[model samples]
Target: MASSPLGHPTRGTTGTNRLRRNDRWIAASAAFRTAADPLVIDLGFGASGVTAFELATRLTKVRADAEVIGFELDPARVATAQAQLDDVRAGRTNFSPDLRVSFAHGGFEVPLPAGRRPAAIRAMNVLRQYDEADVPDAWASMAARLSPGGMLFEGTCDEIGRIASWVDVSSAGEPERFTLSLRLAELERPGIIAERLPKALIHRNVPGERIHDLLTALDREWERAAPLSTFGATQRFLAAVTALKRLGWPVIGGRSRWRLGELTVPWDSVAPR
Candidate 1:
């Protein structure tokens, strides 16, 4: 482990439900659901600890023992989150007073007490500012701290949480899957996720790249499913994802996940070519 946190401080930008989509996805993950530890890390949770609180609230529904720790490299941010945690404890906030949440000063090293490892680590929007070349090391540093069969969800999303995408890295630091999520109700095109892709794929979304091809195909299918929008955006998204799979895009998951405006594929399907 690094002597100090191995990353820079984030912009400290965050809001209520800004990570709702991610929270939902993590809650459904087998890593979190099946982990004996049930401990999740909200790496770089920004200026507020609300995301960590919200994550705990959601994950506890799946497993009451679920706990979350908001991590930041900035000491001030950790203090701020601790203050919020205090508020929650005082019953001044709407959050459960007993919310199993905490704040810590750390970065990609994912510091934990007593050599504890996390079931899953959520690094949403953390690496966007770093160079793409820095992604592998960052992924490795964090993934190294995962428990057996754990995962590292590293990705980006709009501040409003409307559009999101992430790479699911295994405990070995290998990228296993990539996921793209959108707010389908008024989504113009699925390709818009290009702006919020994880650092690994953000720059690779171009001509002849697999990511470019995936986005191009997704846009086409989304347009083709435009008629289904009359039934609702969820229906339209489901149709598009189904069509994408039929077209041999290596799409993963089923209608159940697609209905949330999410489409997943093997990391290789969109890996930089």
Candidate 2:
């Protein structure tokens, strides 16, 4: 396998089900469902391999032959993940004996076996450490390794998975949409997602930016829908998103996803100015 160019070191902080929201989205994506190869890269899967293992388990439900490779730049972290893989292999974990998962030392370059390109690369919290200017190059590098019609889910989430957001990028490194997922019960305000925006938009949350306007409008509608709170947070969020759509904000997804506390919009609607 080819070696990746060195990139930033992550805090390596991860937890059980920390990326569960992301995994759910991936599992439901067309990239995962239609892939003939069904190979996925868990790029920079923190200090543990549980996320990779979980990814494999979830994807296999969609495609029985799904495969997952956890890539990390830190050799020590790769070794630690291997040890966890051993546990899965030894029947000491919840993973099936037939699980197809591995760990390797790599970075944003996404080193993979020759003649292989992944259908999806989930790089959760990987770029949070880099300067915002470095994101394009990092995105280009990873996007270069995707198969045709492949996708990149890149973003960040909190420690407990209560709040999460991601950008859906195509194989050409073009961002398609942005999505914010939250645990409605824990949500205080829709604007709070500004703190976890993808690197490309995180610093663009200031006034005058498109993202700023979007979030500002979201908060306004959310407050305006406060009467729906008597029904539940989910109803309030659904109402808020509907209000956004009515205001011509280019919101994507339907009440089905909104009821689950998710809101998606075209990338152009919030692209950094």
Candidate 3:
């Protein structure tokens, strides 16, 4: 058996539905549609596998044959997650037929007994503990574990399901897009996402940087779209993202996604300066 390379063990703070935003993003992703083996890795799934289980439930709608593998560095956490999954298997917990979730003790190496790489990997709130400079290496290591034409979603979110941001990385170990998903009710300004930006762009939220300009543009557009608040948070968000695009912000995705309080931008539009 090969040892995992992700040396440091995380704090293992697990919670329910904490990764809803990312899960939804994966469920709607094209990667799931064309995957030969629709397997997903819930990298660093913390102390419990509830988030992994939820991810399976959500993705099943897109790919009924999908499977979710939750990985943790701590042996104890892996044991706990496995126990929870077993309970679900034995009909101990309420689970859908398509929710095939499992647990494994692996670090950044993404240990697979059959040397099978996954179609998608979600590592949320995992790298925030490491130094900013370590991000690129970690991204490369994890991205290398992806199947051909696969995706790597690395990001952070608030404790609850609200504010979140992530980068969509390709199999080439390069980021293609930056995404921000937020709960828009009473939003002061879209720039608030700077605090939760992934390690790559978090520190680059300053003048002259692409991320800084992107945030500034978002805030400005958000203010202009305040009138859409009369319709609801969803309408306001749609209007704001649209405004950003009109101002050459390179915003991607459409109203259907923006309706969920989510927006994606090309990597070059917000990459570190």
Candidate 4:
């Protein structure tokens, strides 16, 4: 594959099932279910290929023809992923023998075979290391590589994957929604995601910003929902998110997703102001 025109070195830090939440969200998205092409790109999959494998495994349930390509700027990481692929091929893991996954060296400038473009791109934690000003250009580059109606999922998560947030961008590079997923049982407050916000909103979490106001309001609602804690953290979170919607926070989704500690909002509701 040709080298990406612009990219960054790999931090190479990742763990098994680190992206499970993100994977679930992608599986539920229209982009994955309706893609004319079932090809997906796992951009910047770190030191190991387990996440890529997990992504492929999860997505295939929705579209049996699903395929995943793990891209890393580090050749060594690519080699490691290749070795993992070999293990899967040899029946060393529980992954389906027909699992369609591959590894390649690439970056924001997704490099695919001639005339090929992906149906979706999951770029988790890839942009955290770059300057905020670079996010637009990086997003533009990747979005440009998507097939019609394709999507880009980009965001960050805590080390063990308990707390996560992502932005869903359309093929036009315009963000459509922002989603925050937390482990309700372990959550202390909704504001905890402030630390893990995607690059675009991390610094903007300070007062006066839309994201800041949103999180602050969410924390307040979470506090007010403490009475529901007798039921469970899940119930408490559901109540909090329900209150958020009632208060006109533009919350999306319903109890089904809130039960999983996920909250989605229109991009304009939390866009950096």
lDDT to native, each model: 0.93, 0.90, 0.86, 0.91
TM-score of each: 0.98, 0.97, 0.96, 0.97
The TM-score that candidate 2 achieves is 0.97
lDDT of 3 by residue, 1-273 (tens): 345457487786877888999999999887776899999999999988899999999998888899999988888898988888778877888776347788888877898878898999999999988889999889998999899999999999888868899999998899999999998787778788988999888889989998898888888888888888889877877888888888777778788888888889889888777
Question: Can you write out model 1's per-residue Cα lDDT over 133-232, one digit (the tens) per residue?
Answer: 9999999999999999999999999989999999999999999999998888888898999899999999998899999999999999989988988898
Name the candidate that leads on lDDT. 1
Which of the two, 1 or 2, has more lDDT? 1
What RMSD does model 4 have? 1.2
lDDT of 2 by residue, 162-265 (tens): 88999999999999999999889957898988888888899999989998999899999999999999998999999999999999988887888898888999
Which is superior by TM-score, 3 or 4? Answer: 4
lDDT of 4 by residue, 157-267 (tens): 999999999999999999999999999996799899999999999999988899999999989999998998999999999888988888888898899999989999999
Q: Output the better candidate (1/3) by TM-score.
A: 1
lDDT of 4: 0.91
Sort the predicted structures by lDDT, highest score first.
1, 4, 2, 3
Score residue 19 of candidate 2 by CA lDDT. Answer: 91
Residue pairs in steric clash, candidate 1? none
* Superposed model 3: Cα runs more than 4 Å off: none
Question: For model 4, which pairs clash?
Answer: none
How badly does each model clash, as a count of residue pairs? 0, 0, 0, 0
